[model samples]
Target: MVDNIFKTAMRWALIFAAACLLLWVIMPEWKSVCAGLLLGVFASFLNALMLRRRVEIVGQAAGGNRRMGMGLGSRIAMVLLVAMVAYKNPETFNLPATLAASMVMPFFTLVSAFLHHKRH
Candidate 1:
């Protein structure tokens, strides 16, 4: 069930990233924004994958006495890195667009899970 949700979310993220790339190529005026969005989507996708792995690890350790973290710090660091890059390269990437896009993956996963639950 978790695997299905992860896969669906990843598929949607990829589709969105591709669309952003296509728009970047098709619309020169919007290139910076599209590129920023692409970068953010990539970061968010990676974060999602990391989160899925962390969830699996936590699940596996549920029966044990050891504690496991979801690696939130690492994810935050990744986003900060992307944001810094966008900020440094303002002409190449739009900072606001990048930040906004970075937030989209979790929502995608939530929506996907909700739809999956409804379908079943």
Candidate 2:
């Protein structure tokens, strides 16, 4: 599920990049890119949480602690990403980016848990 969420995020990034470059001809507001990033982050996190359903198989497994492998690195990366956004436009950063980034890490962790269960 971690892999799935990362893959899903990558796919979303590609689609978003293309839209940012191409769609600007139609909708010139670069703010749309920011909006899209907000939505993309939301969607990726939602996808991650949805994928966590795979962890339900833990009931059948001979598990011990059964913990998600999502560690500090990914979280640190997300934090840095958010910080970058904040620094790039401190006064101007909107609520959506802040909210979306806040939600992504737990979603990634949940999906990581699902992947752990699936591995067993």
Candidate 3:
């Protein structure tokens, strides 16, 4: 199940990256937009990795301990880090696009989960 989620997330990220590259090639003026999208894709990938690892940790627990690996604060920090990067360089990062891109992970994850649930 987790593997499926990871694969779906990666597939979406790659698709988005490819689209971003194409957009960059077609409209060089929107380079900042592309960069922001790429950054979002990267953040999503990191989130997926952390999620996978957390699932593995729970699965491998000796008993019924339902502990999580990376806490909510750490995840929020990651989001803030991305925001900070864009905040530090609004001209280059495109704060609006960066914020939009940051949402890709959770959006796709929900989609994947819904699809998985429907299939089951």
Candidate 4:
């Protein structure tokens, strides 16, 4: 079930990334915005992957005595790193677009999961 959701989310993210790349190539004026979006989307994908791995780890440790966290700290760090990069390279990346794009994966995942649930 988790694998299905992860795969669906990743598929959507890849589609979005392709669209962004197409836009970047076709529109020179929107290059910075598209680049920022691409960076954010990439980071979001990585974060999603990390989350999925942590979830699996937690599931495996469910019957154990040790507690496992969802790796929120690492995820937060990744977002911060992306944000800092965008902030430092304003000419290359649009800060707002990058920040906004960074949030897209979770939305995609949520929608995918909801649709899957409804279908089943």
Question: Which runs of model 2 end up more than 4 angstroms from their true locations?
Answer: 1-9, 21-25, 30-70, 87-95, 98-120
* lDDT of every predicted structure (CA atoms): 0.90, 0.53, 0.78, 0.91
lDDT by residue for model 3 (13-51), tens = 789889998998999899888888777777767866776
Q: Over the stretch 51-90, how does candidate 2's per-residue lDDT look in tens digits?
A: 4443544543447656454444455465556656655664
Cα lDDT for residue 79, model 4? 90
- What stretches of model 3 exceed 4 Å from their correct place? 62-70
42: Cα error in model 1, Å: 0.8
Q: Ranking by lDDT, best first? A: 4, 1, 3, 2
Summarize candidate 4's per-residue lDDT along 1-120 as a digit string, tens digits: 867987999999999999999999999999999999999999999998888888778887887955667499999998999999999999999999999999899999999999999999
Candidate 1: 10-residue stretch with minimal lDDT: 61-70
Ranking by TM-score: 1, 4, 3, 2
Candidate 4, position 38, lDDT: 95
Clashes of each: 0, 0, 0, 0
The TM-score obtained by model 4 is: 0.93
The residue pairs in collision within model 2 are none
Greater TM-score among 2 and 3 belongs to 3
